[model samples]
Target: MIAYYVHHQGSGHVHRASSIAAQARTPVVGLSGRPRPAGWTGDWVDLPDDSDGVDASSRDVTAGGTLHWVPRRHAGLAERMRRVSETVARASLVVVDVSVEVALLARLHGVPVVVVAQPGERTDRPHRTAYDLAERILAPWPVRPAGGWPDGWTAKTVHLGALSRFDAHPAPAAGDPCRVLVLWGRGGIDVGPDRIAAAAAATPGHRWVVAGPHPGPGAWPANLTWLGWVDDVWAELSAAGVVVTHAGQNALAEVAAARRPAVVVPQRRPFGEQDATAAALARAGIAEPTGSWPEPAAWPALLARAAQRGGTGWDAWSTGTGAARAAALLDGLAA
Candidate 1:
């Protein structure tokens, strides 16, 4: 059996893992601090959440800039690694999506590592070490610009494109109302309702809807609707004429699958991860990057520009066979 190490910070990691695991040709086990996702078709073992009692001021969490989030003197970190180390004997390979320390740990234990790559300026020493130790690196995006790294890192990577839970969902029905959807990830972002209200007020004609957590106080504007964490997000996404979302990998894949035009507002991430994706979209003419959340006046033009571009062009971003191909790759690795 192969072990899949999914990062617990955001829902995207688990979403990607679930899609690939569903199509895997071999048995797979999931390891994360998160609870077992609802539809994962594999054995799941919960690892300790490393943030518990983690005080960055107290100790060098980065191990003096050589790693990411390896906080010593933390109980959670110790237990988490211990649990992860126990799986070394049973697994032939470990797919990390993604944590550098875990990838290094798996490699040290003699299990081959498939390191999932995120788009960004990951030329840092920690990232270079992880990629160097990896047997393979899986990138979940279409082939595009490499953010200026050594050719060795780029050579080993297999660009598997994007994967999403809504991959099987059909294209959104045509002729939906002229509305704008603001989608956010479960991963904490700073896009506030007050800021959204200002934009919603500017585009009074277009109905504005928001998904994910926005715990700000105040009754919303009449034109704006807040559907806090809906189960049927695809329904909302499908019915919209334009989607305003962050440039997250999962969100982009879902938008690509829904076949709706989108205005991508990239959230600030470590190593400028989302910024790199937004730039790629601009370069490919798939979507335009607003750089940051647009001002109230900028909303009208941005939304209109995205609508005019249309969503059919996203076929290149998500070919609907990414998960199948990734699963086949993992199967070959297991063999």
Candidate 2:
């Protein structure tokens, strides 16, 4: 059996894990702090939240600043580690999506590990340590010579080219009034309510749909529709004339798969992850980037430029077979 460790930070990690697991040839088991998503066929272990039960006045959550987190005297952390150890004991391969401590632990237990690589400035000691210990590194983008990856790291790395849950889903038919879908991710976008309203007002003829966790400040324009959180993202994408989104990997992959033009706004991320992905997209001429949120006045020109691009160079990034390719790699490792 193959074991997968899904990070609990955001939905992206779990979403990517589920997509890849669905394509796995061997039986897959998942462990995460988040509850198992519906339709997950694999065995799941819901780990207790490590941050829970911590006495802030007394507990040191950082484990002496050596690890990202290992709460002091926390039963959840102990139980979580015990479960991971148990899983590693029986599994042939451990796929981490990702955590340095977990990868190290798996390696120390003698189980081969495949670590997921994200676009970022990840040359720090902890990241480097994990990369060094991993048997293989899986990158979900097309092969690129950038990101300043350390020497010898690429030899064991496989580029799977943008995995998405909607790879097999049909694209939505184009809608009238040129619907522009504005997507905000889990962490929220930097653009404020005034800017979003200004953009809606500036683009009079088009329909602007705002989706994801951003509620915006109070009321919105008549032309703009706010969808707090959506389960049917593909429907929105299909109906869109253009997509305006944060440069999150999964979101970008989905947009590319739908063959829609996009304006990618790079939200601040640790290790410059979003910025790196946005830069690569701009360099490839796949999407237009606003280094920060663009001014309301700049919306007309920016959207026009993005529409002109129209998913021209995105084929290189969104092959729609990434999950299959990633599954094959994992199966090979298990064999």
Candidate 3:
């Protein structure tokens, strides 16, 4: 059995794990602080929330920069690792989607660990230690960046391309010529609703639809409709002429799967994670990336440029077989 540890900070980790689990021939039990998602394939273990009622940042969470999130006095942290250690005893391999501490725990137990590589500037001690310990590093992007990682780790990694739940879903034929879609994750976005409204106003010829919750309560612009947390977002996503979204890997992968060109405004994230992704997508010419949203007046040209780029190149990022490939790797390891 493969024990998958999913980080609870963002939905990306869980979404990626679920996609791979769906295709896994081997039993893949999920371990997370969050509850089991609606269609999880195998047993789901609820790991203790380490940050419950605690100021994680204010305390000595990092062990003086040698590691990440090992709070000194947190009972929840202790219990979380204890449960993970129990799982390690029964698992053939552990897939860390990611947490350095959990990787270390599994490695200490002599279980082979495959780490899900995150896109960011991960050149720190804890990250290096985790990478060194992993039997394989699975990168979810098509191309590993040019520099930073040593040769050994670069060779050890398997580039899985972008994995998304939507990869298997066929993108519907293009819908309205004047549709622009926005996707906001439950993980808070740095971009404001007013700014989105401004962009919508700037492009009155295009109708803007937001598929996630409105960040704040407010009346929307004439052309912009806030469809808060729609049950089926693929409809809006697949039909849009252009998708305006953040640079989170899952969001990007979903957009890629739908074959929709995107105007990517990378939100602020730790270690400049989104920045790295935005740069890669921009270089690939599949998405138009900006450090931040441009003025309202600039939205028209940006949207036009993004739509003109089309989404043919998106398959370069999401090959529609990433999940299957990852599952095959896990199955092989289990065997």
Candidate 4:
């Protein structure tokens, strides 16, 4: 059995976990705090049911083979550690995305773990330390030639490329001009409607779609279409010619996987992780950086440049042959 432990802090980890669970032939179980994506076969814990409101603050729920919760802040360290230990005990193998506690628990259980991340320069230190405890560390993008993990760690660290959720989904219908899809996370602080409206107005020839968990009312322009969280963001992703989005690790990879070039605007919040994500993509020559948000007039030319640059087919490194090989390695450990 494969146990997927997701922190639910970002949609990227859940997206990554969904891809892994979908590919696993074994009985896959998921533990997450975020709302589970549709069509995922595994039993998931703490996933919200349809009756649940999007704004509900209920921090914890469990169903299927997963456990989901927002950890209490006042809990003692020992008690929190005990709870994590219990969760780890139930799984033979633990697969985590960028969770430090997950690594600690997996180590206690002697359960091999696969740590998935696209590390930026800032978190490199903690990430490396976490990697020390992991059985294998999976990098979701192509590896740079220098200043990476040491050779002793090389045997365990694998650049599995970017994981794309659209690989199996049917494509969405083509829209007028080229549809530009802009997506943000649950927080409105990072990406606001102003950028979306401006982008739509600046690129008069193109249609713009905004997606995320619905942030309450704002003045939406006629050119911008507000598409709240849909079951098939991937469908929209497939149909988009230009994706203007935040520097979400999974989002960037998904854009690359679709073979479309994108203009990425890094988020300034939560410690500038988006900037790190954008930096790597920019360095890779796969993405054009627009800081937090770019001006609408700037997008037309950037979109044109992205169209010319095209996608680098990074999906093969994560979900394709790379995942297959990683699975084999994991199975060997499970054996």
Clashes of each: 0, 1, 0, 7
Task: Put down candidate 4 lDDT per residue, 1-335, tens digits, no spaces.
Answer: 76777766667787777776666666667766576678788777652222233322443322221322223342433454555566667777887775665676677788778777555442344555567777787776666542455775667777766666665543334332377777666433465677678878888778888777555677766667888887676677777777777776777766655666578888765545676667767676766776667666787887778767665534433344445555665566656
TM-score to true structure, per model? 0.97, 0.94, 0.97, 0.78
What's the true lDDT of residue 128 in model 1? 92
lDDT of 2 by residue, 194-236 (tens): 7777899888878898887655567778888888889888888
lDDT of 4: 0.64
Residue-level error in angstroms, candidate 1, position 144: 0.8
Q: Is candidate 1 or candidate 2 better by lDDT?
A: 1
Where is model 1 more than 4 Å wrong at Cα? 175-177, 216-219
What TM-score does candidate 1 reach? Answer: 0.97
lDDT of 3 by residue, 72-182 (tens): 888998989899998888999999998999999999999999999888888889999999999999999997474699888898899988988888898778757699999
Residue 297 displacement in candidate 4 (angstroms): 3.5
Candidate 3 runs further than 4 Å off: 56-58, 215-217
